[model samples]
Target: MANPIKIIGASLSQNVRKPLAVAHHLGLDVESVMAAPGDDTIKAANPSGRIPAMDDNGFHLSESVAIMIYLAGKAGNALYPEDVQTRALVNQWLFWDVAHWTPAYQPIQFERAIKPMLDMGDPDETVVAAALAKFEREATLLNAALDGKDWLGGGEPTLADFAAGAGLTYAAPMELPLDDYPNIKAWNGRVMGLEGFKKTAQGQ
Candidate 1:
């Protein structure tokens, strides 16, 4: 309905997956570019040369979360919400994902996956250990938030769930000890059950 929005980023990129997942959740038609940092064409689309840029009916947007929010608005406000306070809370989690979660897990993912591909896999174990520790701490906080709620905000999952889950995708394959936090483990399963989540992960 929104002119088959274009998503520029690799399927495996967590940031890229954010908007991809959101689009799938909205049941919107889309075209993916599968761009990466080394791609010249993608560099042209985004001068700063980041993956996960988007072109929505000629309205171009970059930054993963921004693209997700734009698509969410187009998909209608269900994923966002009209309530001012709730919207603010969603924004808070989104900010937390970018500021805290991304910085923590992204580096580890890069070190484990991308770096090896580039033959730059030499990583400082101390740094990886610290990042993982921080991730665990934050995950505990997320577990607390999910204590008895069916979703992050309330009954229905919201952008907060999407945002948090996107950052945590890198941890899934690693089989992080999520069982310790039953609530968070359940939340992860719920997120993975979403069409958007599954599609972005390129899963059946």
Candidate 2:
């Protein structure tokens, strides 16, 4: 039997949730090695010291998207998909998350949630306002894409869902005000309702 996959990051992280969600969804024997930022142990594996690095045997991999793709390949599931077109669609959303979706949500999450937790001070209303504008614009685009679909990539949940929905993992705590985007809210409901998402991402 292969060694269990190692997830190197704290469970609280948005990026860590992606690969963790995929692993749980596939019923993989995965373990979290919980490293906070600046942990030299994790830095050795990923120079960036980023959360959510994966170690399968001795092969180390970083970046949540890359980690999810690798995990999906191991599980031989449709999460990443084998069909060229399907994989392309998943990759497109994954790239979109990194490029657009996450950037808008990160600032809001940091200000509204993480700061308060760390006693870092109150949220900057100006920063939250700016992020709210961006979030509204992006949420509209995303809600349209998810229209009449349970998942982003297609009928079934895929890596795209995990990557694209990572920010929503913080939605409740960050107070994202998702009432306007019914499609997005419903899609997130389905994703969070998954047994895997519940156990790994929702701590249920």
Candidate 3:
């Protein structure tokens, strides 16, 4: 029998959960190994020393987005899609999430959550305020995009949803100012309701 795919990283990490949710959604056999960035295991899989790397048999891969595409392709699932145009749409949101959304929100996460948890020190309110401002700008675009859509890509959930939604895993804990974005709040509810997301949330 073939070995299950190994995902190296902590489950609490949003990047780690991205592929885990997709794998669970596709019913793929996978194992999660908890490790943080800069660990030897992480370095072996990712030269940049990042968490959430992948080892399929002896094939090593890095980057959450790349790993997600690989898993979706391996499963022959529609999450990543085979249609060129549809896949492009998914790619669009995936790139946007990484470039725009993540940059804006991650600072808030690091300040409000990671710092406090790691005893790094009090959050820099100035930094938090700046990030929140940037977040509102990017979120306006996201909110508008989600106005009539349940998912980011199309009617059904796709890698776009998984990627974008994973970033919000700590929304409540981080106290993100999401109350104003009714559209985003509603869409998030749908994303959170997926079986794969639910299982990943429980660290299954």
Model 2 residue 136 lDDT?
89
Model 2 Cα lDDT, one tens digit per residue, 23-43:
888999998788986698688
Pairs clashing in candidate 2?
none
Error at 15, model 1, angstroms: 0.3
All-Cα superposition RMSD per candidate: 2.2, 1.3, 1.2
Q: How does candidate 3 fare on TM-score?
A: 0.96
lDDT of each: 0.79, 0.86, 0.90
Better of 1 and 3 by TM-score: 3
Q: Residue by residue across 1-204, what tens digits does model 3's lDDT show?
A: 879999999777899999998888999999888888889988888888897899999899999999999999895677987889998999999999889989999999999988887899999989999999999998899999999888888789999999999989999868997889999999999988998899898435
Who is ahead in TM-score, 1 or 2? 2
Regions of candidate 3 where Cα sits further than 4 Å from its true position: none
TM-score versus the correct structure, for each prediction: 0.89, 0.95, 0.96
Q: Indicate the residue-level lDDT of 142 in model 3.
A: 91
Local accuracy of candidate 1 as per-residue lDDT tens digits, 1-204: 346889988777878888888888998888887777758756666777788788767777888889888888885657898899988988988998888877877767776655665688576667678777987888888888888897877879788888888776866544366778899888888998888998777553
> Whose lDDT is higher: candidate 2's or candidate 3's?
3
